[model samples]
Target: MLKQFCEHCGEETEHKEVIKQKPSKYGKSKKEQFKAFLSGFFGGVASQVGASLDLIDRYVVCKKCGRKKLENLGDEFQ
Candidate 1:
């Protein structure tokens, strides 16, 4: 749970982090098929840079009114 100001609620309320599906997958490699290896090594990772770029959206939804607000924390780190 997170505490944030919700415009719809007009007050500080509990918010939940929600990651919605990306708008599109064009030009991006689809999620690799799961593979299992029993010999010695485990399955191979799909990306060396971890998560895909803009593959999903982050939002903080108000628990009271169920309103969603975009959480743009990526700009801070960049």
Candidate 2:
């Protein structure tokens, strides 16, 4: 899903489910599933760490429409 922060409501939310390609035959296994889960977990942790370090930008959007809006609670961010 597309994760976006709602500046108007001061909340974090997601819009639609992100379509990710499923693993191929070579990668479709129990071990592979665990690896993928671990990878995602670590990636999310790293991202959070980076955000805490101010190494990334914070994006705000509309909660109901998933539009990028953070300026005046009605205007889109870009």
Candidate 3:
């Protein structure tokens, strides 16, 4: 399961899981697959947060529409 703030509406949204019709037989087990998905999702989040922090450290701000306003902190780190 994946969740994120919608860039257009700034609302929290759940990304539905996509189930394959034919999962690979040689692939990871169910637990491993779950873990991998979670790890990948969080990895993406971590990278985004890190990039945002890097921007703030340089006293810079993104001009991205709704994301900037939602992510901005007032002289503090999230």
lDDT of each: 0.59, 0.47, 0.42
**Sliding window of 10 residues with minimal summed lDDT for model 1:** 34-43
Which segments of candidate 3 are over 4 A away from where they belong?
1-27, 46-78
Q: How do all models score by TM-score?
A: 0.59, 0.29, 0.24
- Please report the TM-score between candidate 1 and the true structure: 0.59
lDDT (Cα, tens digit) per residue for candidate 1, span 10-77: 99999999865444533333432111121102311321122332444679999999999987445444
Q: Is candidate 1 or candidate 3 better by lDDT?
A: 1
Q: Provide the clashing-pair count of each candidate structure.
A: 0, 1, 0
Q: List the residue pairs that clash in candidate 3.
A: none
The candidate maximizing lDDT is: 1
Off by over 4 Å in 1: 27-53
lDDT of 3 at 55: 27
Q: What is the lDDT of candidate 3?
A: 0.42
RMSD score of candidate 1 (Å): 7.0
In terms of TM-score, how similar is model 2 to the real structure?
A: 0.29
